[model samples]
Target: MSATTATARPTRNIESLTERAAALLGGTPDDETLRRYLNGLSGVDAVGLEARAADLGTRSIKTTSKVWALDKIVELIDLTTLEGADTPGKVRSLVAKALNPDASDQSCPRVAAVCVYGDMVPIAIEALGSAHGDPDDGGVSVAAVATAFPSGRASLAVKLADTADAVSNGADEIDMVIDRGAFLSGRYGVVFEQITQVKAACVRADGTSASLKVILETGELNTYDNIKRASWLAILAGGDFIKTSTGKVQPAATLPVTLLMLEVVRDWYRATGEKIGVKPAGGIRTSKDAIKHVVTVAETAGEEWLQPHLFRFGASSLLNDVLRQRQKISTGHYTGADYVTID
Candidate 1:
């Protein structure tokens, strides 16, 4: 299937976040335009998408460029640990690593955030205290995977409760997984409504709300067509970021998948005049892979999306490799794994 284009075009016209939200939810705002745009979306050509992503992956970088990319990618990282064995101690350790990814080099930039399960949010918050300050004050954010993360096969009440628990515990961001089963069944309305409801659940008691990243789990979606649909679905549903996978699935966070997401965010920005982020979790483990992703963001999405606010890599191991590469650039030789903390 080939990708379809409809009324999705960018314009200089911009609207306030409130206006966009009202428009999306109805009443004072209307989503008729958004509905038309989504309805007009066309199929995606899987072969062409894979080919283009492969071609873009071949683009190369040198020493100086790699150095710059390493630092930039560091800031785009969402250093994550979502295992079943995760403990408060483990979350604290990961938080420490995120704050100082490379203790050996003070020049190394801190990661964008530390992602953990909902129960671990308080631990991460405490560990990161005063280290970078609150997220509004330049401190690293604490992200929690909620809404029955990695599966999303739960009731709405349960999901919202899970989200409320995380936000109440001081999570700066909430990475919620959509109900892919509903999405796959062509129940677009169900998927969209759930996202809006989850977005609402992100609000804390202080009138502040956590940033919401809607995970599409592109692996389960199967084709680029579904990925495209899901991408627009999440965005229209008020997702702050459209993520690729949960890392538990095979074929998680591939280059083609991420490249497509970058394109979606770019298109969404053009059509809505609002910027959203793209995060590819799971298999991204090397500095080379990380830089290629940044290159894709620059070429496909634009340089502005290269920042942490608009782009993030969801991996725990990727940070250590980035730090190790930075070490090699500094000392002229690859350092042992022992040189960096085990994240």
Candidate 2:
């Protein structure tokens, strides 16, 4: 699609999310469709999907588009640091890096947000400073991974408190994991309500709700059919974005899985007149891989998803790689990883 077409796209047709849910549920508050709508869905054609994603991965992006993609990639990074070794000092460094990814080039854009464990939210918030303030001057939001993080095994109350603690600590966004066990065991209703409850718990210090990105952990789900169902379920349950994996799981964030996610988001926008964001975390490391994912978003979901608000990459090393590519593009030589600051 042309850049003009992507940028000039009009606002999506949307009413309140509640109304959208009601419509999806066919106006019945206790409708069985809420529980069984995703059941019996056709299984994914894995071979075909992988083949298609492979074909798209070969697209040659050059010069202007390459530069644009690199800049955009910088903005889409989540700049994550979720290790057990995380410290206040580590979080501060990550926040600084997120606010200014490249000190040498003033044109380089800041990252979208800094993702960390719930306890580190305060450190990141303090380092970011007035997150709701002016963006051009310097504004980077903090995203806390809540709901038992990589696994959603805790009790409902615990999960709710986990979400509440992060928001109270000044998180602007919440990335939550779904109950994969419930989803796999045919308890769709349980999974659906879990997401709604977590979303409700994202209310910020000022009472405004934080944006919620539902992590489906597509790696565990194992099929495009499951990914598709999970994506729709998250959207119907008030998720602002549908994320791929937690990056802790094996085989996290493959292109075929991400392609299905983009398709689901695009189709959902067509159905509900509201756009939901897509984030593919885990296993995406290089600038080429990053741009390939960008291509998938543009082609599958339309250029509207290309914006930072609608797209993100949950990664730790992705920022450095993009920066290195930026340096290469400018000076006509590759700078080793030693040159870029590690996040």
> Candidate 1 on 1-343: residue-level lDDT in tens?
0001100112111134436645654533224544555557876778988998888878766666777888888888899999999988888889888888887788887888889999887787778766533322345777889999889999999999999898887777889999989878777777877888888887656555677889999889888878997898788777888999899998899999998888888887788677988999999999878877888889999998886667889998998888877887689653433232211
Global lDDT for candidate 2?
0.79
Q: How close is candidate 2 to the true structure, as a TM-score?
A: 0.88
Clashes of 2: 0
Clashing pairs in 1: 2-43, 10-270, 132-139
Stretches off by above 4 angstroms in model 1 are 1-39, 132-138, 333-343
TM-scores for all candidates: the values are 0.86, 0.88
lDDT of each: 0.78, 0.79
- Residue pairs in clash, model 2: none
User: Can you tell me which runs of candidate 2 are displaced by over 4 Å?
Assistant: 1-19, 27-32, 40-43, 130-138, 334-343
lDDT of 2 by residue, 40-106 (tens): 4566788988998999988876566778889988888889999999999999999888877889998
Give the CA lDDT, 0 to 100, for residue 316 in model 2: 96
Using TM-score as the measure, the top candidate is 2
